[model samples]
Target chain A: MISLAGRDILHAWGKFVFTGVGLGLLIGVTLTMAGVYRGMVDDAKALLDNSGADLWVVQKDTLGPYAESSSIYDDVYRGILGMPGVERAANVTYLTMQVRRGESDVRAMVVGVVPGGPGEPGQPGYLVAGRRITRGHYEAVADIATGFQLGEQIQIRRNLYTVVGLTRRMVSSSGDPMVFIPLKDAQEAQFLKDNDAIVQQRRRTAENPAFNRPGVPGLLNAAIASQSANPYVNAVLVQIEPGYSPDDVAEPIRRWKRLQVYTREQMEKILVGKLIATSARQIGMFLVILAIVSAAIVAFIIYTLTLGKVREIAVLKLIGTRNRTIAFMILQQAVGLGVIGFVVGKISATFWAPIFPKYVLLEPGDAARGFVAVVVICVLASVLAIRAALKVDPAEAIGG
Target chain B: MLTKGIRINGLKKRYGKGETAVDALKGVDMQVAPGEVVGLIGPSGSGKSTLLKCLGAVIEPTAGQMTLGDEVIYDDGWKISDLRALRRDKIGFVFQAPYLIPFLDVTDNIALLPMLAGHPNNESRQRALELLKALDVAHRARAMPSHLSGGEQQRVAIARALINRPPVILADEPTAPLDSERALAVIRILNQMARQYETAVIVVTHDEKIVPTFRRIYHIRDGRTNEEAGEGRAFE
Candidate 1:
């Protein structure tokens, strides 16, 4: 038999296509919401990957550096480096703040790395342009996501640092691009007080009677010098020997150094599971609402279309068209609409993903699942229209 | 009862119960011979529509007997199982409005009945083409229902009614929407098709212009039918 649904759609192709396009845009938003959630998890993972460390050593009992505030002495890495199965260790500090470029400020995660050469645990893994931070101060490697150019001057705090190198995809767990500065500058940026506060502190220190004992004049200067500097770093990143497991090296650091240690797997859990759990839930709620809204729109459209054909349906029924055939026609139309909408949505999401403010990761597996979901939702949405069609009386076509 | 025609005896239909009951068709008797076109005429509120519905098997006669071409369709209740299949294979209907599926072209509209009866698509279309030629609508076979003129649409509906070659055709107000000349033309086509296919045709109508053409007419009033003879003049 000729397809009733196909012929009807062809008869009014413009209406069918325009309706499908509208539905497709809704499906696109749903898919894009799912992609945004995926991107958050990926950004967290990329942050860990670019750190180039097998283990992370943080202050005792702290979640640290990503999920919570953590502070340890900058000298802790030296002790960790001397441990067995340790190939290298480096001090890393993370401070998420606004940094000045020429006129406008850009939000980025300022990273403090020791001015050792490449292959150090905390330095950026690779640079896309220019060299790494080869100097002890005023040299920086900026992630390309910051829109920074090579050899541009950017101010971290009171000091101006030149962006000597540009890296790609090196972002913090929160998706802020990382600006790599030498450890000294970051330490000063993180902890230094303003000049007025420093002067007041110095006055307060000299007035204290314990330091004015008439024989220890050098003690006040030494104490004041100590107050001007910060010796704490956020975490110590460690690389292990070739044959060592992450857990094997991490246990010794926790035992001997008395600091909290996290292996690669545990750090991933901290970043993905704990750090972004609320945002993930928020996206999940949006996805659920979008699905329900999509189902409703489809149901309304199909119902209106079906209602308009009530007379034809009654005539078809009277002319010996089976109830199954009528139901199938309605179902086929709904699925056809869904197929059109899905294609439009996928194309729309693909074209617009890069322009979003945050990263949007669209995976193939998610798309497969989305296609199945659209079909199933369309089937379910057509049920109301099918029921209405089936309830039509064939006798109505032969009026009294 | 004729072997190739439709016969009904003491057909009854009552709506509701007790004081609110309505006896629409009470003990009505009618028959139409094969290759004969009979007119059922009555004023509004008479039992004409109820009788047509009963002959078409669209409504169950409360206490009656109905037989189509020697097949007993209703004794006290339904004698034939699957009333839907009975309607598809043994009965055809034409209505006041053509009511063709707007999406389908003229050929598919006529071919749909045979297709529903499990005929092959090509064979169904062949049958449809033969009827369309007989009804003088062959040139417009591929046109959609919306594009056809009213007379052309009525002709297509008649072709659709004959496509399955059922033993009986029940046409209710088939000329209600046409002018006097177009009404006579539709009746002529129905008569020609009935004679050609050796099928019984019963037309329920109030069109006074075509009333004198039937050899026999059943005039129904207040739940009963009175048989009478017509002038039997051919519209041609």
Candidate 2:
């Protein structure tokens, strides 16, 4: 027998196509939402990967230098370097701030890395363009996402640094691009007072009778010098030797060094499980709402389409058409509409993902699952229309 | 009782109970032999629709005996298990509006009956094509129902009814929507199709133009039927 549903769709293809297009846009937004969540997770992972460290040593009783604020002495990595299985250890600081270039400000994670060549922990892994920072002060390596070009000067706090290199995918867990500068400069930018404050502090010390009894002349200057310097770093990035497991290197740092040490897996848990957990839930709520709206739209559309064919259904019933046959026809039409919508949605997501400010990763697995979900949703949504169609009395066709 | 065509004996259909009891068909009795065309005429609410519904198996009679050909289909209770299948195979129906499946072309609309009865697609189409040819609508076989004129759609409906070669056909005001000329033409086609397929046809109509074409007519009033001879005018 000819396909009753196919013929009906062809008969009114303009309406079907228009409805499909409308549904497709909704599906596109849903896919994009999912991609945004995926991008967050990916950024978190990229932050960890670009660090080139198997273990992270932060202040005790803290979650991270990423998820939360953490501070360790700038010299703490010296002890970690002597530990067993320790290959290299470097201090790093992370501060999310708006760095200025020309007139516009780019929100980025300001990273302070210890002076090191390529392949060092806490340094950008590779550069996409230009060269990595060779000098310790007023030189910066910025992620391409920061919209910073090489040889351009950007202001971070009171210091102006030239962007010497551009890296790709180096971002904080929050998806802010990372701007790398020397560890000493970042420490001063993070904690050191301004020139006015330092001068005022020195004058205040000179007027103090406790230090100027005419007996401790050098003592006041020595105290002032200590206050002028910043000796704290956010965290110590530890690189383990080839033969050492992350857990092995991290345990000793936590035990003897008396600091919170997180392995790669533990850090990932902190980033994904704690840092962005609420955002993921928010997106999940959006997904649920979108699904409900999608199902409602499908149900309403299918119901209206079936209503238009009430006479046809009545005639089919009067002519001894089985209830299942009529139900199947409506069901097939709904699924066909979903299939078309899914194709359009996939294309729309792919076309628009790159334009988003944050990285948007649309995985194939998500697309496949979305397709199945669309089909299942369409099938379920068609139930209302099917019930309405089946309730149509065959006697209606023979009108009084 | 002769074992052929359609027979109805003492058929009754009453709605509600006690004070609200309204009898639509009270002891309706009628019979039509194979290849015979009978007309059922009645005034509004005179139980013509009730009797037609009972004969079409759309509504069950309160107490009655209904036979199609050699089968006893209804005797107070349904003898056949699936009334839908019985309707598809043993009875054909042509409504006033033709009621063709609008999405289907003329050929599939007519072929659907035989296809539903388990005939192969090609064979059903072949049978439908032959019937369309007989009804003089063969040229419009592939045309959609919407594309066909009223006369063409009516002819396709006649072809659909005769495709199964059923022994009985129930036509409810088959020519009510047509003008006099088209009305007479539809009745003439029904007559020719009935004789050609050796099927009995019962046409319930109010069209006076086509009423006299039947050899025998049944007049119903106040839930009762009386058989009478028609003028049986020759067709043009």
Give interface RMSD for all predictions: 1.2, 1.4
TM-score of each: 0.97, 0.97
Q: What is the C-alpha lDDT of each candidate?
A: 0.91, 0.89
lDDT of 1 by residue, A1-400 (tens): 7888999999998999999999999999999999999999999999999999999999999999789999999999999999989999999999999999889999999999988777899888888999988788999999999998988999888889999999999988878999999998999999978889999999998898776457876888888888888999999999999998988899889999999999889999998899999999999999999999999999999999999999999888887889998999999999999999999999999999999978899998988999999999999999999999999888788867
Give candidate 1 misplaced runs (Cα > 4 Å).
A210-214
Instruction: Give every collision pair in model 2.
Output: none
Model 2 segments more than 4 A misplaced: A192-214
Residues B80-182 of candidate 2 have per-residue lDDT tens digits of 8887877777778889998888888999999887776677999999989998889888999899999998989889988888888889988999998899888
For candidate 2, the docking band is medium
Error of 2 at A77 (Å): 0.6
* TM-score, A chain, model 1: 0.97
Model 2 chain B: ten consecutive residues of lowest lDDT: B110-119
Proportion of the native interface contacts kept in model 2: 0.34
What DockQ does each listed candidate score?
A: 0.71, 0.59
